[model samples]
Target: MTATTHTRHDPAAATLLRFATAGSVDDGKSTLVGRLLHDSKSVLVDQLEAVEAASRRRGQDVPDLALLTDGLRAEREQGITIDVAYRYFATPRRRFILADTPGHVQYTRNMVTGASTADLTVVLVDARNGVVEQTRRHAAVSALLRVPRLVLAVNKMDLVGYDEAVFAAVADEFTGYARRLGTADVVAIPLSALEGDNVVAPSAHTDWYSGPTLMEHLEGVEVAAGSPDAPARFPVQYVIRPQSGAHRDYRGYAGRLASGVLRPGDTVTVLPSGQRATVAGIDVLGTPASAARATQSVTVRLAEDVDVSRGDLIAAGAAPRLTRDVTATVCHLHERPLRTGDKVLLKHTTRTVRAVVREITYRTDVDTLERRDAAGALDVNDLGRVVLRTAEPLALDDYADNRRTGAFLLIDPADGTTRSAGLVGETSAWGAP
Candidate 1:
């Protein structure tokens, strides 16, 4: 997004899992996250001591694992997550970046922000409370965001006697509902976050539940398996030209590869202008590289002089579809309502340009998954479909096809504030001319 901030993913590590944790109020999301950290020995002894002291001060008998998270003072006092808290932890096998999102319905936008880039989303649920409205709402959001993996952690199994029937019932229901939303491969695990059962280690209480613990599954899960084979798509973030050095004549397009792979001597096109060029060299952070794959950041020097600049896309194939009129699914993130005829700035890839809301098609009822008629104005956290007319053509792909090239951010032209995250088209719905 132009005015929006994207999470800075770690430089392409071979085995890293980027995941987000979400659930309804009092579902023990924070406790579960803390347990995942504490049981795995990822939390330092000092942090553990601090949590213990805080727990003792709060008149709790045991060290509250939830205290390890819930970092905000207000959150500690109220015992509710109000904002997204990110934590990084790793094991010998794999690395992890966890985004702990909020549970309140009003804070739906926060969940969207956390889960936007997650390779997997872990949605916790209380065994005492079956599938709830907010649970369904979050599952739908994960599916809508095209998060590759889905997990249901049936928490508080101790309170429910660690009964196999109880966990199975909750898991079965959630799995079915998530499948209806197009997430077919959903995994469920029973655990007690507070008592440290089946989180990082296997629980003795669940002899009947024979599945990998949350930690094992997270480490073993394939984060890149969902990506399909496609031609290389690189967006030019910056053009490099040394002014007064021996490399003064050297020019390179520096950016992260959105998809596919690139190598020296490969033919590529500079989009929005359609100039042809060959890759004379590939520079990976100042080192000469023969090839670069998707998600890797590198600079490519073309064989011939070609006009390229920020906001331009470099590709090896026919190139992404260019269009001035775009229809998209949007999640409004602010108090200011989005209405038809509102002029805004659209930020896609490295480009930001003027755009106008042509029409409001419908707003989705998250709880019911129903498309309601034009609501005139979209309130905060409302997901809807709208048509937009941009002043300039954009190179875009369907969000379902490619997350990197298909998603965009809408910005308020006046204040430069990011208003919403937009997904270009869905598998169904949205009637665009």
Candidate 2:
């Protein structure tokens, strides 16, 4: 047997958790990220030395802490993060992949791309500034993305003398606003990212507050294992079949479990066709599973032959509702603008289909949290309600119900680049047609 055939037996290997950081300009997002890396000892000694040298060149009293994360030369000069810089670190508890994203008002698309796969979001806020427009915008994006957990890291607490009142007010303001956007669990913690207070370890300065440190909370938070409780949504990527072997009868449906659970003996129905079959085998990576849960990319073997193809979804419970007409709230992140009647491609999970923008309902003012009607086109960083008519039927769920099923990204068909991020919701009458 070949090496590929021999190594397909092990199932439990490693787990990956992705998280993102967001906040307004100079709110210490990159600083907190640098601190996390610095405190966790994830940075190399050589890298630290380089950053220190660069800091000294700038004539700072201390290392310009932001230097640790601002990798691009232009970013350092501009003193702003312009792209998503991903860093990895681990403790004995769990492995983490952190996407340190840009915080400028113009880079909302980059934020969406980074946060799309994140299980949690940490929105940093300056304690002195209570809550700003970007704070609300970040929180709104977190809610729209269906990020399971939200951590309001109120940074620069020391600047406010670590006063409990300042922390309380900022926390209350953010918590109240987040609730309006449907964030279920919000944890607020005050810290000075630059001073190493309450980031990885607890500081004695805040005696009135008693909560787990950021590191501890990250280690203990229970992330849902692959959305197994949701209805199974397997977007068929490819059909596996063997042609020239003694065991030539092998045929499998290969795809990742987008949501819900699938067991070997469970009966499943394929969407678009509604054909049914019994799952005879489940293969994770290459190893077979007696049962398979959500988020696992496994190849499934059916007991009976069935006609199935790519872009088709298979499920055991009630299938995701199929629709060609969709209304959704979207964040326009493309350099090019979005206008009604524009043709584009909508990619949801593993499936992509042609779609046309039917209407632009209203643009959301991130600063005031107000909806502006009579907007002509959605510009970069603009959030608006949109309606789309697809050329093909999509198996979609409410974003609040199942994020993996309800969320989609719009792609510009001409260049094959993503143009917008959308969350399924209700429609209005005022959108431009």
Candidate 3:
């Protein structure tokens, strides 16, 4: 099928895109990423030379492109990616931050970390193998995390003679599965990462295909526009007070705006304290500003000294639900099992409170999309639901409504090791029931 063509965008005025790559082991993810960087002229001479020397030491005539992203020594020796390797590069039409995540099933937690903040995820598939179990797992994880876009990269097309029929079958099967998982925006492309086909440029071998190259699609895909209409959420990180200065009485709450816009005269409420105040002033980088938007680190002066402190949330417009009971979908990251009645520390934005797991509702089988009910415990890499009761009240939004304010971490209070990553609210179709 021919893909729609987009108008060429200007390179100088392009925006940044954050994307990630994931697939089963040996599906050529790292090689595809390396080729994307090399062909786009994003690689430096010294880096290329290092890769070449490493390839020679391994007794290879040609450079192994996978070496570019497999930075860990154990990974290089094992010929498998164990951790997520992040790379930044820019094309003429766009800039990108690419996270090359591990393809091994045991390291699925690493994939979650890489894709948590990604706007898009490229799921690679070897033409010979089609869509495997790991591929479905990655797609389910992406769907659960609410990754807006997906790319079904059919790699190793050369091994299948670049046959349109082979590509079509794989794409159709994967697309149907992704749609079932509630991932609607999926684009499939046929390419050979080893031969550099349809990656940075179109492939002559696939003359029947008339789709935009991977680079072109990446350059033109729409990213999520900032949440300007959502209610403003700013978690107070620090309380700044001047002792000896022209502004000795300057009192401001310092933190990055998590969402929406904050402006002078805007009415806000401090969470947990339930005190109301108006935004008296905004200071950006020591200079007074008229307004502050999402992600901007600014100090906001309140009209009333409402006894705000670290771990407090300053909200505008709509108020978040303040509660001690939280039902959340979580992915266990630690080897120690998370069981009911286990005491853990829940770390939300700027706030850490003691919590106990009340129940393990169920565990979801990613491959089958089935819910295993009455699960007693969650092992490492398990996706499940949990009911948690905290010692103090927390102001929180649903993960679907606000990712920044709705996400949190569960930590082992004794050693401070992060045990799980959680999202507040009900599970989606692909997640726990």
Candidate 4:
């Protein structure tokens, strides 16, 4: 008897949370992240020693925790974060992938990249400054990305005399603004990243406050487990066929499931061709599988020899819309401006197709949540709407409904540089078209 090996999907691994941090200049985003790592015992001895030595060179008595995250030499020298720094840490309760983003306005595009895949975002605000324009901008970006959870870390509490009233006011203002931006799950916590108050352990200063510590909230927060009812979407990346082996007759469509679950005997439709086929088998890492969930890479064998190729979508349940005209919300990432009638490459899922920028609809004002239509082109870090005409039809889902299948990127065909990140639906506070 041939013993079959099955892929074991561990439930504990689902506790892994991907989160990002954003703030204005000197809001102590790096300090807060460093404090989290240090307090969580994720920092190494050599790394701490290096930070201590660097702090001493700057005539500081205490080690600058911020140095732990500001890895770039330019950032350390300038005393600011110039790029996104990613770190990994784990606790008994959960594991985390942290993207500590830059605070400078010029590097807002870096924040977009970090927070795009984050399940939660920590938006820092200095207690003394309350809520500033950059605070609003970070919140707006978090909302735009559809981040499931938000943490308003009112930092520098010690600098404000650990005043409960100050924390309350800042929390109220930020929460109200976040609510207006359509973000409902906002958790506000007051802490001092410098003095280590209420970050890992609960602080004794705030006697009136009865909320959990930052670490507690992060560990306990519910990570979204994708709904099983969602339509299964698998964008064919590679067609596997062995011409000279025992499996010569076997042909499989390989890709990661974008959402929902796929199982054998499920009826699926091949997009762009509209061919119907049944899932005859599901293989995970060369092992036969009974089912494959979202984000899992697997090879699917169809009962019929369909003409499905790379870039084709195999969908089960609700079908995605097929269209060549795409209206999307985009964030320009490159220094080169995105103008009307510019020919570019639109990469969606595993497919790359030629596309033209039909129009620059409007640029969004992050501060005021206003849509400005006068702008003829989208500049670096500019969030706006645009119309794209593609050379080939694409199967797409609304970004609001499915983050995986509903997102795409605009690439410069000349140099293959990524110009913008786009979402396939209107994403704004005013709900304007």
Question: Model 2, range 1-433, lDDT digits (tens) per residue?
Answer: 0000111121243345689999989898878888888888888999899889998888876776678876742553564423677788886666899987778877787788788789989999999887898888788777767787888899999999999988888888888887777775888888999998999999899988777678767766767766556777788899887667764887888888878888888888887687888889998877887777777778988898889887788878887788999999888877789999999999987779999999998887755656788265798878898889999988888877776778898999999877888988642122223
Ranking by TM-score: 3, 4, 1, 2
lDDT by residue (357-421, candidate 4, tens digit) is 99998898878888798367999999888999999999999888999899999999999889999
Q: Specify the poorest-scoring 10-residue window by lDDT in model 1.
A: 1-10
- How accurate locally, in lDDT, is each candidate? 0.85, 0.80, 0.89, 0.87
Which RMSD values do the candidates have, in order? Answer: 5.8, 7.7, 2.5, 6.8
Each prediction's TM-score versus the true structure: 0.93, 0.89, 0.94, 0.93
Candidates ranked by lDDT, best first? 3, 4, 1, 2
Summing lDDT over every window of 10 consecutive residues in candidate 3, give the lowest-scoring window: 1-10
For model 3, how does the per-residue alpha-carbon lDDT over 165-222 read when each residue is reduced to its tens digit? 9999998899889889888788898999989999989999999888778998899887
Model 4: number of backbone collisions: 0
Model 2, residue 53: C-alpha shift (Å): 2.0
Model 2, residue 361: distance off in Å is 2.3
Give model 3 RMSD, 1 decimal: 2.5
In candidate 1, position 344 carries an lDDT of: 96
lDDT of 3: 0.89
Instruction: Indicate the residue-level lDDT of 407 in model 4.
Output: 96
